[model samples]
Target: MDLQSDLPPLCVTCGVCCTDAFFRYSCVTPEESARIHSLGFPVEREDGREIFSHPCTRLCGASCTVYEQRPATCREFRCTTLSALEEGAIDRPEADRRVSLLRAAVQAVRQLLPKEEKIWALRARLYADPAAAPQTRLALLSMDILADRYFKLKGRRFFS
Candidate 1:
């Protein structure tokens, strides 16, 4: 049921990462700095502080406007590459719990995210393989512990 291991790559071309959907995007290095500028965007400014926002205006029709000159954040923000996303370590019961926890966390972060059927599909996949990823399996176990503790502390079930 480990979804990450069995599911093929899902390119979320919907631009969720580009907008203020979950987290803000920023660049620090000179190369990244250059990349942002190359996109024909002005440096993000807030209350006298330079800050970047997500969902760059450069996105056009479900794609990056400046693909080659995109910022380093866009380049490195490939979460699908995470070991958790890989097939090997994603089939344990803990892995199932981790996927469930991730789904809860993601839904808590953005209800719209769960509306995407991809979430349900991935949730079903967390137990697809049992012997592939031990470390991820352990991390998933820890995430389950944290998720349970979080629910107890908050007094509300995120998924329920």
Candidate 2:
């Protein structure tokens, strides 16, 4: 049986998790770190944890170039919508709709911020600056709310 083929096409079409749209970095084990580094991707230490930063270098336009050799963190990570879909808590169409909403939200935030700035960092900068535009604040809040509702697991820190 081709189990992989039987799986839904959700993840292949939605690579937000592979980018800074969700996380700034993914936690990696020592072995996975070494493997990822060997694959020509850099692994670094952050706050005493081994991690690979995102938007992942291996990601090429929403597809992972090193997917077959991706780290444990990458292989194991699942967004809330994916989990809901796999658990039959929601149907594929709903899951896809959620993904689409989150993507649009991310795009809106991107339009308001610099191309290279991670959402988390920019969020902080914006929050700290009282002079920040209300539209930018609204975009960030909308993105984050959608992210929390559709993607992120409860208490799952993006820095993780």
Candidate 3:
């Protein structure tokens, strides 16, 4: 998803990200590619080297063929907040505040990026720095807390 800070509100029940086999999915590492190829899936050449398509044939409609054995990247990607925001489940003012905090945090981080990372990724470093202001730290914590429940991988989505 390019992992942009301002990515669109989560796909909701739109199921769009799952459809067309996630056209942008590309979790190809040499080892993983070799594993998929061993399963008899087509592995085509791109730029004279083989490229593995993500969201493979096993992705049946909105369902996964192997949810339990899905690759590491897919398992780790948690689009919780986006999904909640899109489903109209997040408390509006809180979501707005969290988003504002995120935007401000990203702006601050960009000045120091390539060294710093996503505000979500750099939460610890920023929060731990004594130099960070109290209000800023509080805002970061709010963002973190909001981020926590926005996506629940273990339960059904809370859509309204």
Local error of candidate 1 at 94, Å? 19
Q: Judged by TM-score, which candidate is best?
A: 2
For model 1, the stretches where C-alpha displacement exceeds 4 angstroms are 1-12, 45-50, 80-160
> What digit string (tens of lDDT, one per residue) describes model 3 on residues 1-160?
4343444332321222232212333344565776767655566766655544543555564355555555555445556555555566764455555545444443444445345243333445665687865655666555444434443344533110
* Whole-structure CA lDDT of model 2: 0.81
Per-prediction TM-score to the true structure, in the order listed: 0.39, 0.86, 0.34
Given candidate 2, what's the lDDT at residue 122?
82
RMSD of 3: 12.9
Global lDDT of each model?
0.46, 0.81, 0.46
**Considering every candidate listed, which one attains the maximal lDDT?**
2
Q: Which segments of candidate 2 are over 4 A away from where they belong?
A: 1-8
lDDT tens digits, residue span 1-160, model 1: 5445464232233343454433444553554666566557667655654446554667664467666666665666543223343445443444445444554554443333334333323333445877745554454455445545422223433221
- Per-residue lDDT of model 2, residues 1-160, tens digit only: 6554575467766888987766778887876666777887777888898887878888886578887888888788889999998898988778879988988898898888876788778877887997888998999889889988988888777665
Backbone clash total, candidate 2? 0
* TM-score for candidate 1, residues paired by index: 0.39
